[model samples]
Target: MKAAVASALRAARRVLAACHESPDGDCLGGALALCLALERAGKRVVVASTDGVPAVYRFLPAWERVTDRVEGLGSFDVAVALECADLERAGRFAPVLAACPVLVNLDHHRDNTGYGHLVWQDPQAASVCEMVYALLAELGAEVDEPVATCLMTGLLTDTGSFRYSSVRPETFELAAELVRRGARPDRIYELVYESRPPSAVRLLGLALSRLQLSADGRVAWSVVDEAMLQQAGARWEDTENIVETLRSIAGVRLALLFKVEPSRVKVSLRARDGARANEVAARFGGGGHLGAAGFVARGDLEDVVRQTLQAAAAEVQTGSG
Candidate 1:
């Protein structure tokens, strides 16, 4: 699959590289790194994201090149979807990708639906960046300083600073190689983790104040509504990492953070070892890694929370037994 994707990319003169809607570090980093590598190969690459780059990720190399609009960009010889479970995960850009003559799906999600003409997926991968690194080698593209920094962001963020169980010996070896190529892990850590605004910190406090645990203490959950965002002067992106915090509580098997939108509630799920957070997410038409997943449901925030918690609780109990 890697060879097939590399061949397609080499053959294409104009390529569209895209990540999922509300992309996190993995998708954005992998896409940008691929974009830089392809450009070096003499291909015209356009990187698109429906929600655009979040402030925390603006430090990535070539971050400014990402455009939220792709409709007016004309046709592409091929489109590459990075870290997207399915084309619909591309948000408004799904149709544009579907229309492309050739689509390559490069992802690391366990529940990937396999939508593209050529698919390369590995659930064990710490991040799609790992796959991207391999692809660059296959294409004989140099991992310059810019490319190294981009790939390193994906590795650090997706592995929770290498704290997650997904990290392997190869993951560390890749990090070392990237560092030798000029990716500064210390700077990346400070920028992505330690540079949160005061508003975001306030939002985190508000969410933590409302954290609730199930009777059995296996499920922990909280909600952040529009009112909280307004009160704390926080944007939706500020809610990042709140679910992981919840999962860190003692005896907690599953953690859920619900962000209440005007018409829908976006729930982020995180689970400890043995708990299938992705299964709970899949129950609601969402999917992700075993330890992390999410879904959006259109309903009252309270109602959605109730339904999701019920599913999560059952999973926790089953895992415990």
Candidate 2:
């Protein structure tokens, strides 16, 4: 894998890098870190995301380099995708990625489709940023302040500030290296966790009011419709941490947050030790890590919620049995 990645990098001068749509911290951070590292290596690179950089991640170093449009993007020799399970997860940018002669998929998702020409899908990886750090080390790229700060953001967020089970000793080791290279944990905490907009806070209250638990108390869920978001003046990004709120409830082994969109319902799932959220999400044509996963389903809000809840409950029951 190292040889292949190195060869791909060496063979390409102009590189295009992208992450999945509605990118979370891991995807955004990994992309930013890789772009910066490649640039430092004297490679011309363009970073992109279908949703672009969220306001919360705007503080990330080189976040401004991410663009949403790739329609007229010129030809590139290699495209490196971070934290993307499949090409389609790139949304409208998938076609742009396909145009590349060489593609590298770097991800930690358990169900990555292995679609790229050179795939580095490590399910054991806590976050894509971790893998990117390893790659940078192997590629002899400079892990300067920009790279460290970007990679650390992914580590902090994907591990739930080191609270998730996916975090290992090696994860902290990598984090320490990043910190030594100039990543500031306190600043990241302030930007990501403490910088929530007032509208997001209001949305949280509204979402909590609709929280419901399954009869067994093994599953907890809440649905946030368009109207609820409008009332709260909240955007979809504002709901980022709300799923964690559901997962924190007593006796709830699985938590779900459903966001109703114009043509589909976006569902984020979080599960405890015995559950696999990725399995539940896969049933609806989505994929992610075992502890955290998500899917998008097209249907009426109520219907999608019912279907997702049923599948999640079934997954919990199956795991228990």
Candidate closest to the true structure, highest lDDT? 1
> Can you write out model 1's per-residue Cα lDDT over 1-321, one digit (the tens) per residue?
999999999999999998899989999999999999999989999999999998889999999999998658899999999978878989888898999999999988777898989999988899999999999999999999999999999999999899877899999999999999999999999999999899999999999999999949999999999999999999998898798899999999899999888889899999886999899999999988778899989988778988998898899988843
Candidate 2 deviant stretches above 4 angstroms: 209-216, 222-231, 235-237, 256-269, 276-318
TM-score of each: 0.85, 0.83
Using TM-score as the measure, the top candidate is: 1
lDDT of 2 by residue, 104-191 (tens): 9888887788898899888888998988888888888889998899999999999879987789999999988989999998899899
Q: What's the lDDT for residue 214 in model 2?
A: 88
- Model 2 scores worst on lDDT over the 10 consecutive residues at 312-321
State how far residue 189 of model 2 sits from its true place (Å).
2.0
